[model samples]
Target chain A: MKYFRYKEEKIFRVLMLVSTLFIVLALAIIIFSILYKGLPMLSWEMISQTPKGGFYLGKEGGILNAIIGSFYLSVCSTLLALFVSLPLALFMNIYLKRYKFVLNTVRFFLDLLWGVPSIVYGAFGFIIMIHFGLRASLLAGIITVTLFIIPIMVRAMDEVFKTVPVGLYEASLSLGSTRSETAYRVFLRQCYPGIITAVLLAFGRGIGDAASVLFTTGFTDHIPVSLMQPTATLPLAIFFQLGAPIAEVQERAYAAAAILTFFILIISILARLSSGKFQRNKINF
Target chain B: MMLQNREIRRLRDRLNVSWMIVILAIVLFLPLLLGLGLFVQSGLLLKELSIWNVLFTSQWMPMSGKFGLLSFILSSLMVTVLSLLIACPVCLLTAIHLTQYAKRYVLNIMHPVIDILAGIPSVIYGVWGILAVVPLVSKYIAPLFGVQTSGYTLLAGAIVLAIMIIPFILNILIEVFRSIPTELTEASLALGATRWQTIKFVILRKGFPGIISALGLGISRAFGETIAVLMVVGNVAKIPTGIFQPGYPLPALIANNYGEMMSIPMYQSALMFSALVLFVIVMLFNLASRIAITKFETK
Candidate 1:
């Protein structure tokens, strides 16, 4: 019986090791495949020039339209989300600090919003656009993405705020500062690094999302010059390019994937570095 | 001058209170409003097609006005279930290894890799699936099973989805396992139980609720995943006869056809209806998981 039990334990350990290795293997496979297939097609032209006519059919031109559009969409939406999420997080953490029930309920709703898939947001945005008699455009995409990322931004910042010692807030209050003053002057200053990380996280999410913008951000070959105009984004560009029957167009899709991956990689690394710095500076008391 | 100063302080307090209320209200109600909007817009489709027909009928010929969602619904279910079957065990085992057995240095390397996996965009996964998994499966795995496909099969989507959701499930399970009191494991070991026995009997029982919740979240993710599954699922509007068959899950269906939806009669409504179905299903799973996690935490 003792020997049998020992064997079982060994088997379990081996299985666990294998599972962990499998995850590592999967990640390596995904990254390698993307780099291998996408690197050759990536170039300055792909990054700098808008697509010419019939770009999806393996013709001349580049994905500059998508590159700029994704940046504009993500940056605008992240800033917009920050505008709402910062106030909301502060309101909950500072103003409603004593109301545990209200805080939990608010967090619950935000959690629900966080779980909402981007495609549903896309459909909801589509409905709103139709109701307003609006066409798919950059503004529509921004609104949809802002909604999509607000929950993520708020929740991440809220977690950072929770880590902040209550003594800091009390110290400010004891100095005769108002609640808003304490939030901005004390909590915000302490949590800015974390806040930046959260914004980058949301930016990464916003920029990579394809489903939410599928209907609201109609595809366009040119860079959007106005909020009312439609814009192409990197994910949508990859999707469109991949769908083409031409081999060269498909290769361009891989190139687009590489670009998207590069952006996300930079954001993730930045988030990690900033969070580490934040941790070192974090107050214990 | 004292009275004027006092009045200014009171006005400022009121202004602060109002600002808080306004921001809180918007943040709190926006998701609810979006849910309601999806629900009401989906109702428009009921005017053209009965709910029973849409849910029960399998043929989804939107051109002839038959907007049956059964195939898509089933396809989504099949893909999600298959992926869960593939991912849950690996995720649970990985979480166990990380929380219970792995050394610190090993974890240091593994954690960032998982984070990077989570950070990767779905579109990249799509591109990778197309370039790698599809070809590999079509050329190798399918033939071994005597099934001939172009590699864009239901199984392919499930594999990609399983990969996409492993980190998610692992993260949740790791949190749950970390919360388990170490004394339970120590007690089991002290009672002459082997490590595997202790894990199977004590840790698994304790973390079962959380594991379920994690799987629920994973299912929700798989069901609603768009680009990766879209790229590999072959996008056929049919009830898949086998894992090797091409299928159209609802998200992919909406994504592929929404552009031309207005051109066809009742099509826009049908797509909206599909989105509503997906929204409700995903929301329910999320709510259940949240409730489960909260219950576990409170316990």
Candidate 2:
């Protein structure tokens, strides 16, 4: 009986071990697929050259235009979202909760937006952008992405703002500091690290997003000097280029995808690393 | 210096009230205002409003003027339901396994892996589905069904979405289970219940609401997802005849059709109407989940 129990336990443990290994294998497969398809043609010219009409597996295709457009859109949208979310979060922390029902309703909306599918947002953007007579322009894309980023920023900042002990606010109050003064100078200053994190997260979300960008950010092979013009993003470029019948276009898609993956990976790693550091520093200071 | 600081502080405090109000207004009201403004600006009500038929009809052809959201809505439901079916049970079991069965060392090792899974981009999951899963499905599963296949089916998309969302559900379940006072489990055992029975009666009950919320969120997440579905579901506009047949969901439809319909009012509104529909459904699901969490916490 004892021997049977031991053997049964061993089998179960092995099964669990194998399942965990499968998870690693799955992740490795994705990373390896991109690298295998992309790396052979990942030369300096491929990275630096301008976009061309005809596809080339070994030459001429570069993400320079896509990268510039993607970076511009992501940065602008993240900043816009931060600008929108920070004040609202600060307001919620400062004044809204005096009426609990109203505050809860506000939170309810924020949470709703947080879970909204990017596709639906894309639809909303389509309706409005078309109405504005904008045809897949960069401005349309940025504004669409801007709204998507806002809820994420607001939620993160709200939590960060809530953590600044009410006592701190009280102390500021007792010291004859006004609420606005304390909020802007003291509270905002204290939550600076978290706010920066919120911005980075928003940027990461914007840059990594493909669906929201598909319709609004009109795909152009050429880079735009103006935000009003349509431009291709890395994700959109990957989708359009890969979906083609041409093998060269497919190879370029893989390369663009690898680059996009690398950017997201870097951002994820940085966020994790910095948050860890912030936690340690918080304990110390 | 203290007097100067106090004066500045007083001035700042006086300035803050209106600023805070403005912030509140923007956060809570911006989307609603924008949506309403856009709706009015677009002249949706005065224009040819065929949204009702578009939403309910079976066919969606923008080029030919025949549009419907039936398949899109149904596909969205099917994908979400299938994903929840796979994800909910596995997540619940995984949570139980990690929280109750596994040793602390084993759990510590496993936790990071789950977190890493949660962190991976959905697009990466789609890529894996295209490369690894589709081939396997076509090679094995589709052959059984007597279908020639690429494996870019609804089943594959649902499975990938389920796998992507499982960690989220598991994480929430684990938190809920861990928070259950250990004494309740001990009491159940002390009262002569078996380990499984104790888990069923006590732990499961304790975690039920959290699990429900997790499932609701998972369903909502799966429902709204676009890129993964677009890539793997094959983007056929018709009602899917089989699991392997191409289908459209609201998100995929919007993504695929929105850009191409630059000049048409009906095309634009159909997409917006779809968006409005999806938004309302997601909002309801979110609200229910939040209420469930609050009710559970209060209990």
Candidate 3:
């Protein structure tokens, strides 16, 4: 019996090790397979110019249209989400700090919103577009994405707000500052790094999301001339290019995907680095 | 002058409060708005087909206005359940080991790795699915089973989804395991339990609710995921009879029918109805798991 128990223990331990190794191996394989297949074709021109004539046939022109469109879309959405969520976060943590029921209920709702899939947002955006007699354009995409990221940003900022010592709020209020002033100046001052991190994180999320914008942002080979015009995005660029029959187009699709991944990778690394770098600057209170 | 200054401050605070209320109201009501919008749009279909009819029928001929969704519903459930089956044990065991047994340095490295994995876009996961999993299914897994497939089988999708969701499920499990106070494990160990036995009896016993919550959230996430699954899952509108067969999930159906869905009558409404179904399902999964989470937190 002793030997059997020991054997069982050893076996399970091996199983755990193998499972963990499988995850690590899976990430490594995914990164390597994609990078190797696509990295060779990556170039400055590949990101610098819009698709020229017969672009899907693997002709001249880059994914510049997608790159710029994604930039505009995510940037606009992230900033919009920040403005919308900042007050919500501040209201919850600073203004209504003592109301546990209200706080919990709001947090729970936000969590629900966070769990909502992006595709539903796209569907809802479509409904709105139909109602407003609008077309799939950058404006529609940004509106949808802003709505999508608001919960995420609020939840992230709420986390930072919670970390704040109540003493800071108390001290600020005791100094004759209004609640709004304290909420804005004191919490904002302390949580700015975290707020910035959340914004960038949401931006990365918005940039990479294909499903939410799949319908709202109409496809175009040319760079968007206006928010009203249908615009290309990197995720959709990859989707459209990969769908083409030619191997060259498929290769560029891989390249576009690689570029998108590289953008996210840089963002995450920056998030990690900034969180650490900013830790020293944060006032402990 | 002091009274005037105080009065101005109070007025400013009042203005800020009202301004905030407007924004907060939007956040609070947005989900309801979305649900209402989707329902109203899908109401176009409900006007023609009963909800029960939509749920039960599987014909789905858009040309003739047949909008049966039974097959899509089943495929979504099948794929989500299968991916959960593939991902849960691995995530649970790995998280258990990392939190309970692994050295600290290993964890420091692993956390960021998990985050990066989670951060990879679903579209890229789709691309990788095409590059790696598709071929593997066709060449190796299918041959072993003596079946021929285009490599875009239900198994291919489940495999890709399992990998895509590993970090999501794993991250939550890690937090769950870590939150279980270490004293319980030490107490079990003092009673002459082996480390594995202690984990089995004490940690698992304590963390079971959390584990359920994590899996529930993971299911919700995997259930509604598009792009990746759509890219690989050979979007045939049929129930997959075998793991190697092609299937179309609801998210794939919603995503694929976008833009060009106008030429056919009831097609847009059908897709919108699927989104409504998806929204309600994801919401329920979230609601159930959140209750479990609250229970675990109280415990």
Candidate 4:
């Protein structure tokens, strides 16, 4: 068994180091270039005004419409996802305790749903919009994004629910609580940090994602006044801006990317910070 | 009266059970509804053309009503497979290094970096692809290969896709390596085997199923990635036999065309069919990976 294993091992070791270096460098270069290119174009007007006439021609308007639209889209979608996901998570972990096969099947399907790309969700959402005679608007986008993030929120909460001690459920039952009461009162109380973290995480994903809302949202130049109105978003804003033949518009795309990246970074950090802050109440296993 | 009170409490609990079950039913049926919606939406196109004609032909002129999808399908498969080929080795090796060899501080530094990479918007990646990868491929790599090409070639798309998936695949691989029991590696080293030999025989053997699952999942992700690939892949509806050639993937096809074509007679249906194809391919890959993961876990 004494083969060229030693040389093979060294080769793999070097390969690992090199590849890791490459990936890290790639990440660094990406962020660095975006910041470099975008910081110059960052202006008060850029975040404060809607696209005026000839905006894509490097004119005098900003992307405030997209900034606000992205906020509304993600916040609204995350809330909708919570309403759908909470009950589903609670049911899987509590009401279906004795139903092992059904539980596994449901869990598997959720996992599959998590892996389903946002683009397919977009397509399906379009179908629904057409069926309901709805236009591509903030409302349609929110519904689509909700469908997109439900599995994510549910799975994250499910992981947290699984960490809960079975004894905790037994203890609550022994103390004369109903299953729903135990689920919402006892388990939910204990799992709030996990639940919050999951929501914020899903929110982060929803905000940054473009494909799910690309067709459904139908970008507009102004902030949407209502759920049914079309609105702009940073991702779509960047996409449309970058496609222009003008150099200034292309650079503005980088600025929009930087803004989107900044929001995502803040969300990730907030998610971690919020989880840490609330974790003090978690019952130790 | 006390008995009645207790009965009411029990009945309220029963109501809760039914409410939960109703939510569960909706949750469970969602995937089915998505599949059905995609089918029915695309059924209009299928009704017009034979399934064989649509799936196998490559000519895709929507203005003339010829909706052959073979080129898009092949392009999607090629880009995804190529990206996986590029990503799998780097991610697997890096994961092994992180878990098996790197110091704790290295892992700590790398964690946020990986998360940030994962969390960054796909549009940023697409923008970066346009900013960096495209130029690099066109000016340097393509010239080196003696090919005159735009930067928006299949290889450029593959490079971006590979980079985009590093965090995803690496996280899975790291978990796989960590799950390999320390006892096996220790026993191998105690038997006078080198660290590399131990990893080659003990760790690799133990983690093989996990590796397969990770790669499978990575493929699923790479295939359905739309914006970044769409930005760099040139959106050409032709069979790409070379890496430097432009290619149009399924998701890209759907994304680029879905917005305004609803007014066209068969255009919306064709785009919907492309989405359906993307969904099915992703599902198959994900199912295979899930099965692999289950097998490894059950072992």
TM-score of chain B of each: 0.94, 0.90, 0.96, 0.94
Candidate 1, CAPRI quality class derived from DockQ? medium
Arranged by DockQ with the best first, the candidates are 3, 1, 4, 2
- Please say which candidate is ahead in TM-score: 1 or 3: 3
Report the number of the highest-lDDT candidate. Answer: 3
Tens digits of lDDT, candidate 3, B31-115: 8999999898888899998999999989888888888999998898888999999999999889988998899887988887898
Q: What is the lDDT for B178 in model 1?
A: 95
Give the per-residue Cα lDDT of candidate 3 at A189: 80
Which sections of candidate 1 miss by over 4 Å? A278-282, B1-16
For A1-285, candidate 2 gives per-residue lDDT tens digits of 656655654665565455555555655676788777777756676667668655444336687888888998998999888777877788788776477778877887788778877766666676568668887888999989998888988898888888888777777779866667667777787777777777777788898788877778888767888878998787777777767777777777777777877887777667656655555323222
CA displacement after TM-score superposition, residue B218 of candidate 4 (Å): 0.9
Error of 4 at B256 (Å): 1.0
lDDT of 1 by residue, B37-133 (tens): 8768777679877899899999877778788899999999999999999999899989999998899999999988988898788988888888888
User: Which numbered prediction scores highest in DockQ against the true structure?
Assistant: 3
Q: What C-alpha lDDT values do all the predictions have? A: 0.89, 0.74, 0.90, 0.89
lDDT tens digits, residues B255-291, model 4?
8887568789589988888888889989999999988
> What interface RMSD do all candidates show, one decimal each?
1.6, 3.3, 1.2, 1.7
In angstroms, how far off is A63's CA in candidate 2? 1.1
Q: Identify the superior model by lDDT, candidate 1 or candidate 2.
A: 1
Error of 1 at A130 (Å): 1.6
Clashing pairs for model 1 are none
Clashing pairs in 4: none
